[model samples]
Target: MSGHSWLLKLPLGKCKSTFNLEKAVCNHGFFMMAPNRWIPSSKILQRPLRLADNTTSVTVLISHPPDSSFLCVQVYHSQTPSPADQRAILKQVTRMLRLTMRDETIVTKFQSICPEAKDINFGRIFVRPLSLKMLSSASSFAIAGKRKRAKSEKLTTHEANNAAPMGNFPNFEELVNIDESCFLEKFKPILGYRAEYILELVEAVKTGRVSFQDLENSTEEQLCYEQVYQNLAKIKGFGHFTCANVLMCMGHYEIVPADTETLRHIRQVHGMKNCNKKTMEEEVRKLYDKYAPFQCLAYWMELLDRYEYKVGKLSELSSSRYHLISSVLFQEDTSNK
Candidate 1:
């Protein structure tokens, strides 16, 4: 594990014209979550990816040159990965960056209708969560770890233990095989109830009650949005907001997750004083209806614009500063409006 790293270059193919690694990785908050690190100085994203064997996870440094046709993935490991491992690494990177032909088409179509989105390459963004299981685990991590902090707060010993340079999540199958206590012990400092829901979802997937193939469109025939929505809704703890967010990650963008952030965007950007929780979804739908199938992307671009405006470039925002990225930090002044 101490030898020189091996580099693998993946051609961008149809996505070459629009793929910008910085925009792709930096546009989403998920990139700031555990295990993913973006270095601003070098414009490289580093993350530990679990190989197909489910036993070995390798740290990979990913970057794309300004006009190059290939995306460079540098695997930091003692041995060169086998062909299977290389495919696994590339697959994970592709999923994380949304670099498929379908994604390129979505970006092209989205920009054609919303010209303002072209500059930021909104379609190239939307990095998928490492896995659905990781989302729940990460959420539990965030919730149970919340506390008041000063601007210069140092990492506590507990936090330091949890914040391994190479993150601590096991592969999906590996996670499914673990007993409840083992799972909890591994994901220490997590909300107990949140951890329960994560286990439940994992069990459901393992038992064929819900299929990731259907959710992620790995099947030969694609399931309609309604079908996928209903499937995800059956999972405990997956409300409208969670389902929609998950759906967006799965490449369905017609539905936007209308949380408090959406309400804030509606109020500040659209001047909707009365857009409360009840009317938030309706208001957001109306705002981005023109974007149609790409409604989430459109809404996300607006939010990203406001975020970067307030916090400066996300690429430059250190991973250590991720804890400071709360809604209050990006809240805009709207009293005069």
Candidate 2:
């Protein structure tokens, strides 16, 4: 685990195909999860991994065999990573590969609920509803002048409840991603109005109107997926497509966060020979209606099948595939859903 990066064998207990590995590290396709710098391709995923302390950066190559039981991760650098760094790498790997691990009982329960999804490589695409943790972190809130407190000094339940101002608990960056200058500069064409909406989202987070954790636990709190969807829809810049994908990321699979790519895939794979935006959406909802509450996951699985068959992997395809995911205009009155 040290001295000029080497290879390590880690078990992939629940992942059935190496294609899941591609999806795990490749969040947006053709583009990395912003600020993480995860480079992905058909055969390998490369990333500059920071140790848990953030003082060091190490590059690693990740891959696995299709349908194999274990993943092969290679850490390559001039210096060896520490044990903590190795653990960080593993933890991040597990996060991106959510449903592919042995110990994630939440994923298992979700699979039990959606047995139809047993064949789908669920991955981070789904999460345990109430217990799901948003990917927001202290660094995300640092721009607002809130720094994390000492980790060794744990807060009690009561202090934690009253500790909103104690540290950088508000994560404005996750939505706007101000940390990545490159994304803000060059990708303005991609995120245009959504970028403005992120500022509103940060305000919502800061004002305690909509906590990220609230969205995470919405399902358990008697908020039906649609109610939560409406709640999120109330936010500025959130339309059918943005709200849907946001909820999907928060573990709601009832909707597919549909876009033109969805339209294209439905046209190409579902045998819908001709389709405008309305027809494409109707076809998708019809195709996955039987799998309601699991439609997003189901749709993603189908799309992934076609995607892997086409390129054998996923890059930051989210932005590149749907070049106009948010900003593109569709047929009149068709809406963004």
In terms of lDDT, which candidate is strongest? 1
Error of 2 at 84 (Å): 5.8
In Å, residue 32's CA in model 2 sits off its true spot by 5.9
Top candidate by TM-score: 1
Candidate 1, 1-337: lDDT as tens digits: 2234677988889888888889888988888876677888989887777555644566678888778999988776546689997887898788888887777888999999899988767776656535553332231112222321211123335433422236434445545656778667756455666787888878887788877655555212456667888878988889999988877877888888888777777877787887789888777777888899889889889888878777788889887777655644444534333
Candidate 2: C-alpha lDDT: 0.55
> Candidates' lDDT values, in order?
0.71, 0.55
lDDT of 2 by residue, 1-337 (tens): 4434467666876454323654454534423333333333445655444446542334456677776777777765444656876776676666555643332553455566667455554534522111234344323234434333432223345433322122222334444544545535654577786655666666677677767676656755757788889877777778899888877765566888788678767766775767777677778778887766667766776766665555444554433544443232233114423
Give per-residue lDDT, candidate 2, residue 194.
Answer: 65
Candidate 2, 152: how far from true, in Å? Answer: 23
